[model samples]
Structures are given as structure tokens and as C-alpha cells.
Target chain A: MSVINDLLGGFATALSLANLMYALIGCVLGTAIGVLPGIGPVAGVALLIPVTLNLEPTSAIIMLAAIFYGTQYGGTITSVLLNTPGESASAITTIDGYAMTKKGRAGAALTIAAYGSFVGGTAATVGLVVAAKPLGSLGLAVGPPEFFSMMVLGLALLVCLAGDSMTKALISGVIGLMIAMVGIDPVEGAPRFTFGNEFLLDGVSFVAVIVGLFGLSEILNTGTERPGKVETPGFRALLPNRTEFRRSNPAVARGTVVGFLLGLIPGMTGSVSALLSYGAEKRFSKYRDELGSGAIEGVAGPESANNAHANGALVPLFTLGIPASPTIAVLMGAFLQQGLTPGPSLFVDHSELAWGIIASLFIGNVILVILNVPLVRVWTSILSIPPAVLTALILVFMVVGSYTINFAAFDVFVMTLFGLVGLGLRKLDIPLAPLVLTLVLGPLMESKLRESLEISQGDFSIFASRPICVVLLLIALVIAATPLLRPRRRKTRSKENQHEAA
Target chain B: MHEQNQAAPPDRPSPPAGPGPTGPPGPAASSALAPLIGQAVLALVAAYVVFTSFGLGLWSHIGPGPGFFPLVLGVAMLLLALSWFVQERRRTATPAAAPAQGAATATEVPEVPVIPGIPSTPAAGTGDGSGGRGHVLAVVGSLIVLGLLIDLLGFQLTMFAFLLFHLKRQNAVRWITAVIISAVGSVGTFVLFGAGLGVQLPAAGIPFLANLGL
Candidate 1:
């Protein structure tokens, strides 16, 4: 099959010494970001974009993409040892993960989690390889109308699935669009919201905004709490027993399936995939009752799903040029920065680059397993870092990161302003994911909508006239309507959660 | 509002448990109408956008001009923010909805594996959780100063002071430890990124400082 040959070609490109080193470095830094508090992958990757300015596009993306997936495995460490889920997908793991820590089986739980993430990521990469060609072809067939509709669906889904209130999420998305409109009118040469500042010409630096939004805001939010040093206890058993392995295998399989499938959908977040994977384990695992306790299956299933979901989310980005999550949107921003638009045309125009990145993903996953297993002690030691010291260092990095973007002090100011904005949004529980995705997609969506209208001579009927556009729009409509129709589910779920907490 | 000031624990019970504050705060007087303030502000922004779009040009025979998309977004924002206001007003009327509204924001505390980030990470702290406002103000103030002074004092000296302030002032870190860390972070980072990677962090602006090779 041509797929085999193309993949082989991809391996040849990926096997280059420079590409391998980049992958190794990406996985390492990605794990650090995951383990380190305050810097999320969105900000971490965004922070590093300036550093990659000198590299070839393929190597740059390969490294950034590795950081993206590397976070998946890194979050599990805190979930198990510190009773802190480094990320949301790892949140479920904290139940059994911490329980295992309590039972002094922390090492086994961590090992299983790492292995599960590897299996899930590897499996999902296979899915991407198999599905990318067909999906890219399908994406190529879409016209401007359909493309516009597809973006609508993505945004609608993002808003619907974002937060407790769809209204807040919608507001966040709209704000993102507004922010995106701040620079020059990409269509016309006139500036809209710049207020006549030269720095506003390129729009707010994406790197500055992102670092401020995700990174600095976090520092402010947790600034008060001085995390006292906690000693990491030594591990009892480093690897799972035979029974633990047997129990984990099926959950890994189930998590991979759930994560990959959910990842393929428009609005599914890693948290959703992990949550659903947890639900599946509860329903089907023979040891389901032990889920809340120190059960390896609990640690394995969701971590696997979380990592798989991460890689699966890439399918949409690679094939359709649509970022499935906020993190992916940031990655897409990186792609744009590299002067490479991610979409079907990428495959045709730069198959070697595309496949090279794909091959690097699998390599990244392997490097993660190899590196993380031996580095667990080092990773755990990161948690022992004083919050004050860590905060200071992170702040310096953020400052340097923003300054290096265009060597502009204006960007540091922008980062500070958005940091305050980020704090306010978090305080109000406004979802940032929708804001991020909309921000990244705004220009493209605007351009596509304008092009479609141009083709139709300003007639709006073209959107409805096309079957794919109609169906995509309908799907968007349905997703938007879900909360309105099932208001009780939303209320009950929140209430139930509140009651359980109480 | 003060109740909301108390940050949420790292882990909270939810349909899918997430980390972060669940909502705004408790029903302070039940009619605590803070959400409305945000909605009103957003509505005003939307209105401004709509007003400004007319100047940029709207739809044309050749199709959408630059303003058309922003116009649509601005109008949609206006309507949506208004809807949010209405929703909040209705919830304010319902006493039971008050508490739920404050807690309903916990959908995912949203740690979507997409970006395994730091959110609600202080639950492990054994210290008394207090006095965040000062720390936040200090951080913000210092960051602004960094931005303003980086071009003048240069990256190394500015970062040295910034890191020194954070390390010493925040936790009463030992003066020796603080200086060592700050020096390494500033001078060391400058060497790694500026010299090695050729990132070109700002050199001192003053003639004397530049001559000193700062």
C-alpha cells in the first residue's frame, strides 16, 4: 500500500539525528511543563516558539508537537504522588493514583500510568496515520461555504462543551474574536481596534497573549499559596505485578478506543475522554468497585485515554487544518508562525514534512516512556521545589519569553495586561479554551466567510444550498441547543457534584 | 465577594472532577449581582465594536468588507451578553439557583490534557492560605517595572532585581540564596539564551552602562 511506503519515507526523514534530538528534547521539556506548576503546554509551547525561529520548519514542529503530547504523561506524576492532577485528564487518576500512594504502591501506579500513556499515544498515532489521508482528501473537497460551516460547528461545539454556563463560554469566544480583530483588517488594509499604536499593527502578539493568559494568570491565582516542601517517599515496587498488568491491559485498550474516537470529534476535550474512559471502567471492569481505591486499572485507563486523546486531537489539525482543542490551536498558531498552514494542502504540498512530523510523534512517545521511567525520581523532585523559587524562575522565563518574541518591551506590557485579564476571567470561571480556539481560528474563519460570500456575490443562501454546509450547520445548531434542551442535566450534575463535595 | 476570594481546592467533586474555584462565591445577600457587572461591560464592548464597524465598511457588492465579520461578531456578542444578563437576573430571583450558580462553574475545572497546566495547585500547601492580594500586586508591579526598565537598565540588571525581589520578598528566602538564584537566572540565562542562542535580550541603554558591558 502507498500508506506503507509513505510511512517508511516518513521514518527515513524522522530518523535523522537532528529530528531525533528534537523529539527527545521536546518530550523532556513537555514533561517538565506538565510536572511544573504554572506553565501549561499552551504557554510552554508558546513560550518556546521564539526559540524555534532559527530551526527548519519540520524540526521545529516536531519538537513543539512532542511537547504537546509529553504533557499528557507528565501530569500523571503529581496526580499519583502529590494528590494533585497536573492537568484535568490526570484528575481522575488522582482518585486511585493517590490511593495507591497511600497504600505505598506509588511506583507501580506511576509505571502503569506511564505505560498506559505510551500504549494509548502509540495506538492513536496509528489511527492518525490510517485516517489522515482519507480525511485530508475529504477536507480538500470542501468549499469555502463548507469550511465556514465546519468552523461554526467547531466553535459551537467548543462553547457548548466548555464550561458550566454556555453563555460565559460564548462570551469568551466572542471576546477572542474581538481581540483577533485588533490588528489590521486582514481583508482591508485599515486597522480596527489598534487605538493608533504601532505595536497593535500585528495584533497583540499571540505568544505574549498566550503566555499572559495561561502562564502569568496562573502565577497570580496561586501566588498567595506558598507550597511548603514535601518529601517524596521512596517507592516499594517499581513495576506492576502480573495480575496488575493483566488488569491494566484491557483498560488500556478501552482507554485507547475511547480517547481516539472522542478525539476525532469536534469539541471533545481530553478531560471528556478521560472522564468517559473512567465511566467505561466503572461499567465494565471486573474490579470496578476498586476504582476509587488504589486500583491500577483506575490509574491506567484514564491516563491512557488522556494521552491517546491528545494524539487523536491532532488528526483534525493535520487533515482539516482545524485544531480540536485550545492546546492544538496554540500548536496551529505555531504552524502559522512557521509559514505552514496545516490542512489538506499540507499533505500535497509538503508530504515529506507532514510525514516527518507524523513519524516524529511516534518517536516522541517512545522517548517519553524511555525517559520518564528512568527519570521518575527527578520528576518527583520537581514537586519538592519551593513555590516561591519556582514562581520567581517562571516569571523570569515568561518575561524573557515575551521580550524575545520581537525583542519588544511592548509585548511584556501586553503579557502583563493579559495576565490581569486572565486572572479576572479565571475568577469569574469564564472558560479560556473557547477564547483561545476562537482567537486562533478567527482570521481564517473570517477570511473563509468573506471568500464564500464573494463567490456567492453576497448571497447568504450558499451556506444552506450546499448539503455538507447544511449538515455541519445543523450539527452546530444541535450542539448549541443541547444545554437549552437538557437544562436539568446541567443543573443536576452541578448539584450532584456540590452535594458530593459537601 | 470575599467568600469568592478564597480560592478553590485543587480537587473538587464534580461529574468529572476538576480543579479550581467552582463559581463566583456564596449567595451573599442572595441578590449578589456581580455577574451582571461583567455582562454589562461586555455588552458595552460589543456596542462599541458595532459602532466602530460602520466606519470600517460593512458588506459590499463584492462581498464582505473588513467590517462585515466584526459587525456580525459584535452584534452576536451584544445579544449573547444580554442573554447572559437575563439568565443571571432570572437566577438571582431563584434562591436555590443562587448556590448552584456559584458552584455550577465546575464542569471540568478543565485541565483538558490538551494543556496539562497549573490550575488550583495550592491544596497541598500546609501553610495558612492568606494574604494573596499583596503578592499578586507585587508580582504585577514588578513585571511592569521589568518591562519599563529592560530597555534602560538592560535585561541582566532588570532580571536580577526582578528575581531578587520575588525570591526574597515572597518567602523571606535567605539573602545569599536569593542573590545566587537571581544571579544565575539573570546572568546565566543571558548567557544561555542571549549569547548562546543569540536571542538578543536588550543591552543597557545608558552610555555608562553600555560601556561597562552590562
Candidate 2:
């Protein structure tokens, strides 16, 4: 009853006219962004941070959160119509989704995806509402030493699962930490790496760096390519048969469970959930044989899982102050920019704002279904716009966005440098997720480590002496040493994977 | 599964695969030089940080000083660079020690995107893997030029040229189309953001241009 009452109060705040309008705008723009060829949710969300700087913190966060989940559904449009994923999470959907389009059931596939997303996203929001207070309570019990160790664990998980090479991922993570190390030190207020530059005083701007890495690099990568062909699914084609909906219902349920569970882990992103869902459908779905042949279950399950993962990711950012994925890491940056610290403190200190943001997510999910299902043709047409035109406009926005950060030419240059760095990293097959995660975590991790040391009177054993800290660090150590310990096992597994593919 | 690449069959024209995640990092041994260059840069950066941290003071009475963490990070980076150098030399020394098993399999299946929104692979395809460098270089060079010229010629003028480069030079659209698109992108955004939204933008650094309302 107390939870329901709190939620009802949240409804009161979220239902205000201005807040609702921001949510709507967020959903609309997010859909367009997801439909864009080169940009994905990370760049899309980061680009909007500068735009949101003018709004109140509550309204800013509400709009950005709406955009985050909205892209999940929007990405489905590209998958079904063009056989291209708007984002990586939707990549698996292209297999069955494009097949459905070939069979003249593109509309049915998209409708099911939207319905699955609405169900999964709404269910996850309910989970968030139910789980927020307790998780936050548990988080409050952790001290600085534990917090420091936990962040290390978070980085380890990120690098371990992020890409092909953990070394490159770790290197990226170190670079991010070094980036954060610029500017005034939190404790002593002495500058560490400013090199006497005024702009470096605040550390490298997060928005500029990401906009460079994600947006600019994307344009440079895909700028010259032509847009692919997409067949528009007419309105009459949208109605899924009774059988189609009924068959997909169970897959949606299973996907929600899988996605929500995986999303709880610090480094597991929505694409991982979507992939596992795809794998699960291959193994456990009743219509497994039809998975790659335009079966509705293939479209519904992974789409649901990805959407569920997007919402479920907010749980950790809210409760434990850890970002679950790269996109969520940018969102966490928004929270920090709003002058609010996430974690247990957010719940206690800003209950109204916290609950309001959660409530608005429910409203946003409803808005996304409406935008994605009946109006999906609008998005397909977006794919028709000349790639040259879109790329040019995006670059313009990128420059303007970076410039507004502090009204400086310096940040724009920083963005350009990172764009080159991003290109180099991408070409090298180094994962960007670890860099993004550590960039968000670096300052906070540093503060906690310093505080823990202060409490221990500068004793290094403070980390090893505390039971929770020791346990967390041990987990991190094991993960970090896996490459050294299990090289033979890794090679064997790859061999097996090759054999299976053959 | 092999299904990853099958979705985009060869018959269809697709977005440039943007240097799809280096599969076996390509066949050329010349590519191995990249790691050496990376190590040299990292080693130099690490050395600078260690040297700078000594001046910043590593310890304070209460706890670690501002430099303490940077010092640690510097040493960590040096260690990782050394490790990479060692690994690469060993692999080069014995080319046949390990077969290209991972590379062979990599071509069969693309890197699964573990993170949503990120491709893990930057470009899905690299169209012809040709003629893209010039356009990319143009963007980089233009951005730097914009940084230098934004204050001189102002936001409107530099943005106009930047957009024009993408539209006219790289993309090779007609002059009218390029002019119109670049105009709308530059002047229109300048008005919406600078005038309407009241976000500050550079007007001009020179007294003459500022007087002319650039």
C-alpha cells in the first residue's frame, strides 16, 4: 500500500503538463534518432545532454530517460523494414524480421515487436518501482572501502565481457581514468593534469568526448555510404493474426525474465540480453525450427528482452550508482550533471524527483508503443533521406553541441581529438564500452578510494581488512586474471565454436 | 552463427562496413607496426605522467595526495604497454606457433554486439574500402579549422564552409543542392540556437566582423 501510495504521488508529479510534453518530445526524437543510419542511442542521448542543459534537473532527466527506452522500440523499425539494425541491440532481430518482410508480414513482425516491447518495458518499470527502495537500502550499508572495491569489480566485469580482447578493453578503461584525472582533485582542490590550461580545470567535458567518439566517428565511418532500400509496410499490413500474437506471448514473458535478470549485472548490456533471448528461442521456443524463417517468436522474444534490459538497467544506476551499459553510463552522466548523486542517497534525499522519473518511464513506454506500431512507416521513410544530407546535419549538430558545453572552441577541439582516437580504437577492435564505463566511474571511484584511505589513516590494508571490500576485490582479481589462468580453455571453446559453425 | 553476415547478402548495396572489426587484423604483416607505434606512444605518455606526479607530491599527511593516484595510474599504463610489446614480439617471432584459427572463425561469425547501441564493430561494412579516407580527413581537418576559424569568421561563416565541404566536396552533390543545404544547416541553426534559444555562439573575434553582425 505504501508503494502504491508513493507511486500515485509520483503520478501526480509526472502528469504535469510540461513534464508530459518533454516525455512526448523525447520519445519522438528518440525514434528519429534510432532510425538514423549512423547514430545510435549513445550518441543520440549524449547529443541531447547539451540541449537539456536549460531545463530543470527533474525535467531534463525525465526527457533523457524517455529517449533511452524509446530508442529500444525505434531500433526495431529499421530491423524489420530494411534488414539493418538502428542499434546493436536490434541486430539479431534483422534475421527473422527481414525474413518476415520478404513474406509480406513486416507489419505483423513490427506490431509484435512493439507489443512485446510495451509488455516487457512496463513490467520492468514495475520491477524498478518495487525494487528501488530495498536495493537502495542495501546500498546504504556499504562504506567507502566497499564502494571502492565494488567499482573495481564493475570495471572488471565491463572489460571481461565487453569485447574480444580484455587487454585492449583494460587499456581503454585506463585511458578513461586518465581523462577523468584531469582538472582539480576532489579532495585537495589542487590541479592534477591541467597543464595550466583553463579549459582542463573541469576535466575533459564528458559530452564533448562522447559526441566525438560516438557521433563524429560514426559520421566519418559511414558518411559516404548510400542508404539501403526499405519496403514500407502499409497500415493494413500491421494487424497480426490472432495466432501470431498468441504464439508470441510466451516468448515475451520468457524474454522479460531473462532480460531483467541479466540487466542486473553491472556490465551486461541490452544486446547481451537480446542475444541470450535469441539463443533461448533457438533452444527452448516451441517454434524453434521456424526461428530464422519469419516466425513471430523470433521477432517478439529478442525485442522484448532488449527493451526489458533497457529499463532494468536503470535499477543499478538508481540503487548502486553503477551504470549497466554505455548508454546508461551517459544517462548516469546526466544525473551527475544535474548535481545529484545516484545510489542510496538519491532515494532518501530526492524521493519526489526519483519516483517521478520512474513514473514517467511508465508513461514513456506507453508513448513508445503508440509511436512504433501504427506510425512505424514514418520511421521507414526516415531511412530514405539521403545519407549525405543526414550526415552533414549530424556533423553540424555535433559541433554546435560540443561548443555549447562551455561556449569554447577548446571543447570542440577535444571532441575532434577523441574522434580520431575513437576511430583508431574502433579500427583496432578495441571496445568503447569499457572506456565509457570507466569515464563515468573514475571520479567517483577516486573519491571513495581517497575517503577509505583517510578513514584507515593511510593504511593500505583498509581494503583487504574489510570483509566486503576483500570479497569484492577478490572477485575483481579473479576476473582480471582469467585470461592468464584460462587461455587454453578459451582456445578450446573457440575451436568448438568453429566446429559448431562448420 | 554464419547468419550474421548472411543478412546483408552481396547482391544488395549496404552502408560502408566502416572497417568492420579487424578480422585477424587483416593479412599484412605491415599491420603489426601499429602495435609498436601504440607502445611507443603509451610509454612516452606514461613516462611524462610519472615525471609530473613527482612534482605534484605523492603523499599528504591525511592520506594520498593529488599526485598519488596519477602516479599509480602512470605505472599501471607503463606495465600494460610493456605487456603488449612482449606479447606482440613473441607472436611475430614464431608465426607458425599458432595457426590463424581465431581469424578463420572470425570471418565466419561477426563479433556479437555485447553492448546495446554500440556495434562493438564500428561500421557494418566498408564500401569498397576505398576513397573514404579523403572524406574522413576532410572532416577532421575541417573540425580543426572550425576550431581555429570559429572565433575569426564566427559560427555562421565557418559552419557554412564546414557543411559545404561535406555537401559539395566529399558528398559531391550539385552546387545548388550543396549551397541550399549548407545555408539551411548553418544560418538556420545559428538563428534557432543563438537567437531563439539564447545560447551563446561566437559572433566574431575580429572587430570588423563583429561590427558586421557575423
Q: Provide the clashing-pair count of each candidate structure.
A: 1, 6
| Model 1 CA deviation exceeding 4 Å by range | A224-236, A488-502, B1-33, B102-131
- lDDT of every model, 2 decimals: 0.81, 0.81
Q: After superposition, how far is residue A200 of candidate 2 from its true place, in Å?
A: 0.3
lDDT of 2 by residue, A1-502 (tens): 8778788888888999989998998999888887765678888888888778877888889999988888888888888888878887888899899999999999999999999999888898898998998999989988999888888987888777665456667788888888889999989999888988999999999999988888887666555566578788889999999999999999999899988877788877787788889888888998999988899988999999988888998999999998888889899999988898888899889988899999999999988888888888788887776777777888888998899988899999999998878776655545677787888888998999999999998998999889999898999999888856666886698789999999
Give the TM-scores of the predictions, in the order they appear. Answer: 0.91, 0.91
Q: Which stretches of candidate 2 lie over 4 Å from their true place?
A: A490-502, B1-29, B94-131, B211-213
Q: Judged by DockQ cut-offs, is candidate 1 incorrect, acceptable, medium or high?
A: acceptable
Check candidate 2 and list the clashing pairs.
B16-B125, B17-B124, B17-B125, B17-B126, B18-B125, B18-B126
C-alpha lDDT (0 to 100) for residue A364 of candidate 2: 94
RMSD (Cα, Å) for all candidates, in order, is 6.0, 5.6
Model 1 superposed RMSD (Cα): 6.0
Clashing pairs in 1: A88-B111
